[model samples]
Target: MVPCEDYLVSMIDLPDDSLHIIFHKLESCTDRNAFGLTCWRWLQIQNLARGSLQFKCSHRSSISDNVRYLSRLLGRFQQLNSISLAGCTELPDSALTQLRSSGSNLRTLFLDCCFGITDNGLSLVFAGCPALVSVSLYRCNVTDVGLEILAKSCPTLERVNLSYCTLLSDHGIGALSRECLKLRAMTISYCRGITGTGFRGCSPTLAYLEADSCLLTPDGLLGAVSGGGLQYLNVSSLRCWAGGDGLASIGAGFAKNLCFLNLRLCRFVGNESVGTIAKGCPVLEEWNLALCHEVRVSGWEAIGSNCHNLKVLHVNRCRNLCDHGLRALQDGCHQLAVLYMHGCRRVTWVGLESFRMRRWGVKVRGEENVSVGPSLDQFFL
Candidate 1:
């Protein structure tokens, strides 16, 4: 048998191709770092094998030092195809210019909360990264010109998130919708400037959208759902002139593929809107109606009769929801697994106990430790 030293030497003598295969199998950074530290050859191979880099700088670090360090890392990791500088608030436009060297290989870029990156920086970086497929710029200082540049430069983009990018308007969104033909998922939440008119030219490949707190209109809402392929949508707190009419139109037009919806804090949603959703969205599995006090007995009855596949429901603070509405749900939604009824003052203890007796498996939440005495007429059914 050979000595232990000889065996170690033989293991290290493996070909570079064989070592590259082993290096990629290492899922932990610690293990990969240890492998790289084994020798100079191993370190060079590890750098070449590295495809993704995530650099986060602490607030205590000097901005110049952070930029210098990141520039060195970009120079060293020449094969990197994905880069995430999320929450690196101090990074300026000059730091992104370092990307010019490796931009051709990059496919994913995330610069969330990097306030210093403006339209100029975006124009500088995107002109080089032609193969980019996914980009997220949450809370960035980018405006319509920057977005227009991105749309025109990267035709292969498939997923983008511009949430809280306050400077973005309908013009930017319109450019993105018209240019990015392969885009599938987009999040524009809290973009108050967008009135949803840009979505009229949205790509048919787009299926998932989250535009909560946007200033939407009936025509805009109609254009978004008319595609008949949307599966996930969240328009909570949508600011519209007549929200009830917009919601009713959504139920009437795009009821085919919807699976998840969040309508929380929509003050104008009334019985007609809820009833229409119940009848239209038959495959609906989850619905949030919290703080919607306008829904009465008729709306609850409609939900119970239709939404058979419903598994989760939130009706918190529904003042008009009493024993009648509770009974309708308990009798109909057999697939119900979770229910939230925290502030239903009109629902008495008797009704709650009766519903619990019928559906003991369901998780009833937000109604703990409350006294509902028989003498109290306020809580009486």
Candidate 2:
């Protein structure tokens, strides 16, 4: 057998393709870095094998370091697919311009909390990267013009998160719906300007939609999702305008396959609306009705008997909930694995304890102490 030094030398001389196969086996970033540091040959091979990179610019030193490293990687790796610059506060538009100049066929890009990325810089991104499939601009300064440019440029975009993009309005959303036919999941939470018109007459290819805290009226929702197979829907906090009638419309028309629904803080939602949901969504598995005070014991009874597939229920801060409601859930929802009832004033220790003692009881953290049962965080864990 050869000596240890000779074996080391032979390993370093392995073909580029073989080295790339070995790199794929290294799961952790630290392990890959260590392997790259073994020798110059391995480092070159490692760079070639790389497909994703994340840069966080916290301090001045990190910013400079990231710039230099990114420049080198962009020059070397043409196969880069994913890049995240989340929380890179100091990163300027110039850096983004440079990244786009690399002409990488980027599939996923996250610029969340990158405060420096303006419309001009983002315009450069959309213009340069047409192959982009997923893009997030959470808390960025991107406006309607940038969105318009994005819609016209990237036709293949599937997922987009414009959460907290306060400047974007219905015009931008309408453009996206009209142009990006392949778009699947969209998160427009806190974008108040987005009304139902954006989705009107557009294709119903969207499966996931999170439009929480928006101005989407019930009719607008009906018009927007008329044809799609929407599975996950979060229209929570619609100023209570989309009440039972609105929910009923959704259940009857758009969301037959709906599994997850979050109507948290929808103050207008009562037993009538929830009853509609029970009858409409037969496959519903998770429901979040936190702070929906109008839903009483009758709603719980309806859910228990009708929504048999529901495995997770969050009814926190529902002031009207009492012992009767808990009993309804206990009797009907046999598949329930998680239940949250914190801030439910009428549900006392006695009612909660009896359920915990039974075989069907979920036995979540707060089950041990009937009076002050578990907090909301415990159920989530």
Considering every candidate listed, which one attains the maximal TM-score?
Answer: 1
What are the per-residue Cα lDDT tens digits for candidate 1 across 131-225? 88889999999999998999999988887889999898888988988998887778888987887788785777776778878887877777677
Error of 2 at 306 (Å): 1.4
**lDDT at 67 for candidate 2?**
69
Number of the top candidate by lDDT? 1
- Candidate 1 has a TM-score of 0.88
lDDT of 2: 0.78
What stretches of model 1 exceed 4 Å from their correct place?
A: 1-13, 58-61, 243-245, 367-381
After TM-score superposition, the amount by which residue 372's alpha carbon in candidate 1 deviates from its true location, in angstroms, is 30
lDDT of 1 at 197: 80
Estimated TM-score per prediction? 0.88, 0.81
Task: Estimate, for each residue in 1-381, the C-alpha lDDT of model 2 and write its tens digit.
Answer: 767875465675677888888888989978988987888888888776768878666474766676676666677765678888888866777787666744546888899998877988888888899989889999888899999999998998888999999898888988898999888778898987777677776666776778888888776787566645667778888853734545666677467788778888887788887898888888888888888888898888999899888887888878998989888988887788888767788989998887777735574432211211122223114
Kindly state the number of residue pairs that clash in model 1: 0
Give lDDT per model, in order.
0.83, 0.78
